[model samples]
Target: MVAYHSSALDGVAANPALPTPLLLRLIAFDGGGHGPPFQALHRPGLPEPAVAAVLTHPVLNARVQFAMSGQADAEQRARLANDSSPRVRAAVAYGPEWTHDHRTKVRPLPDAVCARLLEDPEPSVRSALLDSRHLAPSFLASLVRHPDPAARHAALRVWDELTPDGRTALLDDADPEVRRSAALCACPHDARLTAALLRDSAALPEALSHGLLRRADAERFLAEGVHLVELAGNPSLPADLVDRLAVHPDDSVRLAVSLRPELTEARRAAIDFTVAPHAQEHVGWVAAGIADQGVLRRAATSTHPLLRRAAARSPHLPPDLLRHLAADTDVVVRTNLAVHHPDTPEEVLMSVYARLGGTFSAWMATGHPHFPREGLAARFADHPDGIYRQLAVRDPAAGPDLIERLSHDPDVWTRQAATRDPRLPLPRLLEALALPELASSAGANPALPAGEMAVVMDEAGVPA
Candidate 1:
């Protein structure tokens, strides 16, 4: 599978007719006063012409230059390291595609470039560097004592890599926040430190809740009558204390107790818990450990709805389980299966889209590979709801006239979808490029010929 993040301009970039020279021109198109420069420069393995154009195109603006820096070669990065623009330099510091978590195996910057960025005058550049996984161990150790408390906390992402002295420094740091972060990093391994963190009022709630609290410490927290809400959710809390909190006077405490993973449905029913319909918190069982197929199957068939919801999030579920959950009575179960499960049936995705048409999850559902698009024009061309009408453009059955007419649809989503559909005639497509609202989708429509795209670039004032 091609491991690339989808971009709005991907169809334009992927056009076979878009020659090297024209793609290079995209690096300097200046967006025709519409939006950011064409994102083709951010794709991997740019031909030498595109690389040279980015390096030597003095007229290229800062934002386009920043896009090139994401995929720059070591030599290109070395040049960008000294570029006058802080944003460009910041991009160099962060390595390739740092903003997106797609690429994991990134080559580190040259040692000199790393040294320069560490002391770079711009805080944004240094901040971007902290987020990059390409930073060397030595740089990470130095950042542990950085003047900025946030940097000190961020550096703890690689706590095991830090020197023993560096770890001790964070644990004993004067800043309570830094110490609290260190406690989170160290508590799982060090019981003594975990016990100490449980005493500090500032750290008590998080430490008691997240750390594996000792049995005695769990009892102590219960006896104190403080942080009961936090204690109720702690996995390490003694069974007796968990029972005691299930009936605690505080509603929040019982609510937390009711959601604990160890509690069976019968036990949870005994608690006076009022579930907020929209915001019921389920255990993130997938994150906790979801590899065992047996455990996943049990979760899928569990009597508790939350367990079924968690099971639906497992991407590796067998087709039988997916079918079972897709037909599950719970809306969240069906939606989660559609959004997260790779083999979710086409019918389930359309159902979720119908229920959550304008939501983020609905966007994800429509983007799924198996989403139904082939005959949608016949089904939704004149649906009363504009969201349903937008599906018409996705259907091959949608005629050029239908697409052009929908391009003028009052609903923005329908209009945008029509603008991207290749069936929309070229003249109307070019006209859509002038509308700031639709330029991005129009610019990406694959039907726009390579010659016309070059003309669009030239009109946008690309350098010769």
Candidate 2:
């Protein structure tokens, strides 16, 4: 036997290749015999050629793989469809390069591959395929059947691309997201589909249901009409709704309707059932819109003060009615007529003033531009009532002579009113203030007698 001494070989070697025996021994040291093959293909400074050689090398090719998911270049991508490693095959399945047309190239991944990936112990890979825009429809359908809510949501997003029948099938989907998407994505123009959606109360979101019910164009559905009925049934329905129902033919239904602008004449006439003061007041107003002067005149005598007042204020009230209301026992009704009655005679107004003293006369005097100021002033001067005298003095229409005469009037309010007269001259103001009796009274009561003092002081060059 030849003795191969390692120390002798190291000394003798000078760029000599490894001996055949040594080479075999080194190759066998690697379990798979792949070490020498890989080293040969991965030599430094020759990257492209080395990689190509490794991909094709008989011994190393079993460990190498490429992604062939899909691409416009079908044949090139399909060449790696049978790649050994699952990672490389999954890369092919989700490769960005695989556009819609490239999907056909991936024809049939093995059942094992599909099932394993579908249940992919890894969620990320499964999710990518589930959400892929270019995913095959058949594959997506299969995925939707998986017991995953996320997969169903993803499938629903693309339901519109499916055939009409396919979309209809999703309406019964176990997942609400899928069902809702089906309802919303159904062709709005298709009345059948819209009706179907409307019928499935379970599948609708509250907002979407409301939107459909309120849709102006879908009037044929009578959805709004139904809602209006529901609103009528609501015990908390607005008073306006009851007012609307007041005229409804179905007395029962009418009770549900509130006050709306669309109330019919007959319906409005039916509101007479309401005897409450406020209800009567509103009815009187509504009646004024429809009733003649005769009817309003009758209402003006209504026991309810508000009804009487409304009748009195009616612009369409006849002259005869106004004359009747001018003598109303209710001061408010009388006052209303005094201020608003266009045809009320001057005599009737003056009579109202004389009978109903206080601010009633003042209100009439202020509002009626044609009120007889001289008559009122004379009445004030002669009348035993101090309030009448005060009202006459404050009349803007009162002449200066009447005011001057009233300036010396015995009543303090009468004199105060006279001083307030914008027409009262400076000399008269000073004279009224300087009188011993008037000056003493003016000093005693600051507010009542202060008016003449203000005028007199202002005329005397005193800062007002």
Candidate 3:
């Protein structure tokens, strides 16, 4: 068996591709209250056999059912919504965001189940329902005036899209805190109200960060000097104000200005902004969502390195533009292309990893689906940097002896990576599992024989 390096070495329970029969056995094992044993059931496209095991297993724990709640089919979801355990019910109400593998996006529960959850007898379940992103507009409207202030606050997630009547109700809410939140939520869409709220010193910072700011207001804040950072980040700041802030004395403010999407390459380069070694707050490209071809084309060709980097982050960039960014002069741009672009070429990902392999963010490039494995061992096994040597274990062509040698390497990460390699001998793999530091990754190595897995499960008090 070969290691699937595309997935992280999280643990056995998190491995989405575990065989269906094994998954069924895991479902039958009671996890007590611990999470891992049952978590695998959350994987997308969970087999019908595994789902049946979770639902029918006589000894299945409530936590087991809780973990599978989100990915449950429509009929199963309805059953879970009325589950005997409140915790299980709450799990369904929360609407888990992603399937266990992080591949499939989980959809909202059926409308009927959502309606029942809205009025669930347990306040915990009801509270969980409010946190769900899938709630309908009408449900949110009903929640905005809920007697519980927390419920009303939770409903404000949809405040920007709330109906006029809903907004009015929240504006006049009995709770002063609720009223304050309502004002902030309405500020972007209600220019007159934003203008009025600007006069209040307490509301000024958040207002400048996201609320619409007129030229006069920006100038006044500039003179005041306290909110310059927020002013630079404000999407609605006027063009002239944006230009003025680009040259502002504060480095943070200038950095923020440099990231504004409206600035041309020349304007951005003139700012003398410093790109921090690590990422700071997300820039305009992130907020703008998926950009159009025209926007991406301009960003890719921009003289400003950060603009090119921003374009690299666009997953939908055309093939030519993707290649352009892959070969970009800036390492950051190329790295971003490797990490974010779905179609980044194999060579680009390898190059980025070879350069940044020791860096914390390098995993993103190495773990990319397109990363090459054919010659990795031969290329990096003798490299001076242990980080590069660590990658040799990922090479499918590497032999058992090489895997064993690396498993004993002095570099902790190298040892860890080697331990996860399926090529490691059975005795060595079991030895790695005995070591607390390496056990998790060792268990995650899909190469472990099924008979051995059953024995391991039995030792954990989970008999097949």
Question: Which of the numbered candidates is closest to the native, going by highest lDDT?
Answer: 1
Query: Candidate 1, residues 67-90: lDDT per residue as tens digits?
Result: 334555656556667667777778
lDDT of 2 by residue, 319-413 (tens): 66676777676666665666665566666566666666555444553456445555565556666766677667645577778777777777776
Candidate number with the higher lDDT (1 or 2): 1
In candidate 2, stretches whose alpha carbon ends up further than 4 angstroms from where it belongs are 1-280, 284-306, 351-361, 391-402, 410-412, 422-425, 430-464
Worst 10 residues of 3 by lDDT: 1-10
RMSD of each: 6.1, 39.5, 5.6
lDDT by residue for model 3 over 337-438, one digit each (tens)? 877777889978877887888774477777778888889899888888897898798888999999999988888889888887888998998888667777
List the candidates' TM-scores in order.
Answer: 0.76, 0.31, 0.76
Error at 57, model 3, angstroms: 7.1
Model 3 stretches astray by more than 4 angstroms: 1-25, 31-45, 52-79, 95-104, 133-186, 200-202, 214-216, 233-247, 355-360, 399-447
Displacement of residue 231 (Cα, Å) in model 2 is 14
| lDDT for each candidate structure | 0.73, 0.47, 0.72
The global Cα lDDT (0 to 1) of model 3 is 0.72
